[model samples]
Target: MARGAIPPLPVWAGEALDLITDMPSAEDLVTAMATQAEGALIRAGRR
Candidate 1:
């Protein structure tokens, strides 16, 4: 594969491999950020 190009997964194993390894999506990032913020807020409240 060319540099920065993602290789196509074999059709038969695509589903399985995708579950094992995949890049994070935008929603994943937002969710993670929100989760961290919530944790920080909770800790601040406890202080």
Candidate 2:
């Protein structure tokens, strides 16, 4: 988040917490979720 990277969500879905001090768009959150999975895969050498 500090580096502008999206962190992964918790196992259970809940209300969104705006940590950026600003509201995030639906698409932005979706992209963050996707990027999180991709980042994990990359760490496992899958990407």
Per TM-score, the best of the predicted structures is 1
- For model 1 the local lDDT of residue 5 reads 80
- What TM-score would you give candidate 1 relative to the actual structure? 0.48
The per-residue C-alpha lDDT of model 2 at residue 38 equals 99
Query: Compared with the true structure, what per-residue lDDT tens digits does model 1 show for residues 1-47?
Result: 57978667685488777876787888898999999999998989952
Q: Which residues of candidate 2, in runs, are more than 4 Å off?
A: 1-22
| Residue range 1-47, candidate 2, lDDT tens digits | 47966666761233344454467788999999999999999999999
Cα displacement (angstroms), candidate 2, residue 45, comes to 1.4
lDDT of residue 36 for candidate 1 = 94
Clashes of each: 0, 0
Candidates in order, TM-scores: namely 0.48, 0.45
Q: How high is the CA lDDT of each candidate model?
A: 0.81, 0.74
